[model samples]
Target: MNWIFLILGGLFEIGFTTCLGKAKEATGSTTYMWYGGFILCLFASMALLIKATQTLPLGTAYAVWTGIGAVGTVLIGILFFKEPADFWRVFFIFTLIASIVGLKAVSSH
Candidate 1:
């Protein structure tokens, strides 16, 4: 259950970050809308993370959450932001994913 919340938090982390980039690109009233969405997502993400920490070890939870967000955000950048999908970049992303999985497997809770 805590893992679920943690993963949700991670996904929301991705959401807020992407929205933040969009917010930066927005102009005038649209900028305020984007910023509002960004803030909402950011708060939701943090709230879920706080919930997850109630049961999960903080170090493991934070690492896994950030790991998922980082990997997800990078993939999103590749797909939507026209970032290069170079070999080394993909390799490290997979490595981070593997590490996150390993951490989940080793975690007691």
Candidate 2:
């Protein structure tokens, strides 16, 4: 359903972000591939996000899509890219999740 699109959009957003990070670290042809993948995934994610907003409320769709994408990407960065895992990062991510849940509740009304 629409929720599926939202989730897929979020996943694709994460994919593009991760690819962007990889592209920054890559060189030569591999760099171009990563850059291309990042751009393609970002466009696809935005299109799917728009589709999701048609059924879901705007606030709900946007919050869920962006929140999940951000949190998921940060997690990936920490795990795969070896990004720092400090308390402040965890706190902000939790805050984002809370805001997403709050937005969903408000949008349901």
Candidate 3:
């Protein structure tokens, strides 16, 4: 289903973004692997997003995809990369989630 593709695309977007962050910290040959993986995942996710948008409205698909990706990436950054996880950061993330959900609900009609 189109939603499935959108979900997958969002997941891959998170994957690529996380990998890019890792690549920035990497050194030597392993850096290339991370960069390459990031690029591959980015392109793959974009293709799937395009496919999903064909069936779903562009606005809905983009909002959902970006919302999921943003949340997932921040979580990954905090958990895996030891990024700052202050109260303000968490609060903003929750706000973003709420807005995204609201938008999706309102637009679905």
Best by TM-score: 1
Candidate 1 residue runs with Cα over 4 Å from true position: none
Mind giving the per-residue lDDT tens digits that candidate 3 earns over 1-109?
8888988999999999988999999999989999999999999999999999987889889999999899999999999999999999999999989987887678653
lDDT of 3: 0.92
Native-vs-model 1 lDDT?
0.94
Provide the TM-score for each candidate, comma-separated: 0.97, 0.89, 0.90
Off by over 4 Å in 2: none
Q: What local distance difference test score does each model get?
A: 0.94, 0.92, 0.92
Q: 2-108, model 2: which lDDT tens digit per residue?
A: 88889899999999999999999999999999999999999999999999998888877988999989999999999999989999999999999899778776775
Clashing residue pairs in candidate 3 are none
Worst 10 residues of 1 by lDDT: 17-26
Best-fitting candidate, measured by lDDT?
Answer: 1
- What's the ranking of the predictions by TM-score, best on top? 1, 3, 2
Give the per-residue lDDT digits (tens) of candidate 1, residues 69-109: 99999988999888899999999999999999999999999
- Name the runs in model 3 displaced over 4 angstroms: none
